[model samples]
Target: MSDESSNEAPRTVRLDRELVRALAHPMRNRILGLLRVYGPQTATTLAGRLGVNTGATSYHLRQLAEAGLVIEDDSRGNARDRWWKAAHQGTEFDKAELLDQEPELALGFLHGVGQSYAENIFSFIDAVQTMPADWRDASVLSDYFFHLRADQLDAMMQEVLAVLEKYKTADLTAPLPEGAEQVTVQLQAFPRETR
Candidate 1:
């Protein structure tokens, strides 16, 4: 699935406190994830996948749209149906800055983000052995401890994202290779808490 919107700038946007607060709900995170990983879809489709009714998905979709986390795709579906997609493929923020400015709100935001990450990580673990050998070998599923300054970590994070972006198929409209599959590349660069 393509991450970038058809008529917008690249699908990457920085988040502010208000936006983070808006995204604190777990359902919002899951809905956004589904959209990002599968391209634009109608609320009914998402509801079916999520095991929820259309009304529940439609309500959350509206809330997400209000927060700029999602946008309506008028090009898709008929007048009777509305399609929704992620407003951005990714989001970023300075943890220190957020905590310094609004600690509680940042925690709330991070909680939702962290919940999503944990879920994905567990899902990956559960499905890793069932994947093809080549894909399993290509998988990146490890964390390492290292001594580094904050700037150094930031630089490394940028390099990793750069590599991922280089190989990304940003536009869903383009035809991809026969073996092409939408893959989620989840990354985490954070200090390990010590007791």
Candidate 2:
């Protein structure tokens, strides 16, 4: 998630060992993602949405805040119902660097991220049958295998990301037009060892 092309540059945070360690927890990752996707929300609200207890949600939120992944949004909510939001719209890091520096931390963080992506894909699959004709027709769950050098793959990924960024919905907080829906697009590129 990033900023609108017309708006100010997107806020991005670079991941370090400490930050990655903080985000390695599945719950904390989910909390940060919820705040980013849906905007600021109280622990109670997040708990209800995530089906977690308020206490647990609050604890995770506090951890994320301490790690600088999220921040208290003083503009909304009162003392009793404090609101929290994602500090950055997106994150940037070198996976190889992190893996080399802290294998366990990197693996844990990547596992959590991969699990989230799988969950989203499964959710869509579960609802696809009941989805409207228009949406169902528009949905995609396909992958292509490409044989390319590392540099070629990297260049292709950059091009793909640039295209996605161009078409990304500008304001998450803004009301969507009729028939519009929030869509999730996931991209994964890695060299698989041949059997």
lDDT to native, each model? 0.83, 0.89
Give the lowest summed-lDDT range of ten residues in model 2.
1-10
Q: Kindly report which residue stretches of model 1 are placed more than 4 angstroms away from their true locations once superposed.
A: 1-10, 172-175
TM of each candidate vs. truth = 0.82, 0.91
Runs of candidate 2 exceeding 4 Å displacement? 1-10
Candidate 2: RMSD to truth: 3.3
Q: lDDT tens string, model 2, 106-141? A: 999999999989988999999999999999999899
Window of ten residues with lowest summed lDDT in model 1: 1-10
Tens-digit per-residue lDDT, 1-195, candidate 1 = 343445574567787877777777777778988887778989999999888999989999999999888999878889799999888887778888889988988898788888888888898899998999988888888778898989999899989989987888766434567997667677777888878
Candidate 2, backbone clash total: 0
